[model samples]
Target: MKKKFPIIETDRLILREVLKEDSADMFLYLSDKEVMKHMGLEPFQTQKETLDEIGWYQTIFKEATGIRWGITHKENGRVIGSCGFFNTHPEHSRAEIGYELSKEYWGKGIASEALEAIIHYGFQHFQLERVEALVEPANSASLKLLEKNGFKQEGLLRHYEFTCGKFDDLYIYSILKGDVVTT
Candidate 1:
């Protein structure tokens, strides 16, 4: 059988891999300035930039270390966002997790659902000992989501990323295997 994503369903959403057909939907959300703010991106003014991102997702399966998941609504079947882990440190059996949701889907619990599912999948399928998420300090919602999902705030990495013309500090959070509530 072909390898399959966990394909989690939590009442309102389904989390799965990003597909070629999802380009337009991904572009729509990625192009929104407000949605793209915290996410490290200067809105895609050209369709090619959007296509490149989708293409990058499509090529993800060729790797053994990283995986990405698309978040779609179960009721309308629209892809509202994505979540996944990447930049794995094989020796330490750890990786960084990241996520982004469309503006329309904000304030809902979709981001948390997608994150929990992906974290579970990582431990279930990989030899991972821990998963880390680096969030911009200003993204309060993201900080809350990681906390609710059993991650603990580690500290800030000053000047972690230079995005949209300014240096941003990344607030690091980590969830280890079998953490009180993570497993």
Candidate 2:
């Protein structure tokens, strides 16, 4: 049997499954050049692109490969961003975490909240021994968020990936299950 999509709730946010209906809202930020700058993809030019992204989210979940959640605001019920684990390796009990928030919602502690919820969920439900995040060195915001969440900087993978027409270096960050402090 397939597992149902999990819904994670934070104090002010709802991290739920990404639905096709979220395309428009997703497009709002995803189409922003600044938002997509470190995402390794060009800003989405059409709703069709957003839909494809949603489809990929569904596919990963269905295949037991990974999962993504639309980060919805509890107050306004708007999907202001997304956060998730991908490149999941059950055998190794590890996965890569990725997230993006609408620029409008940046610096408001939203990403931090959503990230905490998912890190907890990933460690518990996914049985993940390690949750990792790959971030461009220039992405200071993400680096700070990861560190605040207890993820340690592993090392830089130089020219690790080619995206958006150039090679980019990525700093890998990880939080081990043993590193988590249960409150």
Candidate 3:
């Protein structure tokens, strides 16, 4: 049987499946130079690109390979960002987590809330023993966020990823199932 897409809710945000309707909101930030800077992709040029991205999200979920949720506000119902696990390995009980928020919502504790909800879900629902994240060294905000959420930096994977026509080093951070108090 296929697993249904999970929808997680926090006090202020909803982490639900990324739908086709979210493309415009997604495009708003996906096309931002700053938001896509460390994301390994150039800013999206068109809504078509955003549609392709939404399609990728659906594909991964359908294949049971990963899950990406559109981060929506409880009050406004706008998809302000997205967060989820990709590169999932069930045999290894691990997955990589990634997220991005609109610039307008930065530093409002939104990302932190979304991360907390997803991390909890990942551990409980996905049975993930280890949830990892690859973050660029220059992304101080992400580094701090990971640390605050109980993810410990393992080490720098030198020249780990080739993106945007160049090699980039990324810090590998992970939070074990026991690392945080997940309920």
lDDT of candidate 3 over 1-183, digit per residue (tens) = 877888898899988988888898999999999999999999999999999999999999998898899999999998989999999999999999999999999999999999999999989988899999999999999999999999999999999999999999999999999988876
**Mind giving the per-residue lDDT tens digits that candidate 2 earns over 1-183?**
878899998899999998888899899999999999999999999999999999999999999899999999998888889999999989999999999999999999999999999999988888899999999999999999999999999999999999999999999999999998633
- Taking all chains together, each candidate's TM-score versus the true structure is 0.90, 0.97, 0.97
Clashes of 3: 0
Runs off by more than 4 Å, candidate 2: none
Q: How close to the true structure is residue 12 of candidate 1, measured as C-alpha lDDT?
A: 78
178, model 2: CA deviation in Å? 1.1
Q: Give me the displacement of residue 72 in model 2, in angstroms.
A: 0.2
> Could you give the C-alpha RMSD of every candidate to the true structure, in order shown?
2.0, 1.0, 0.9
In candidate 1, list every pair of residues with a backbone clash: none
Clashing pairs in 3: none
| lDDT ranking, high to low | 3, 2, 1
Write the number of the candidate with greater TM-score, choosing between 1 and 3.
3
User: Judged by lDDT against the true structure, how good is candidate 3?
Assistant: 0.94
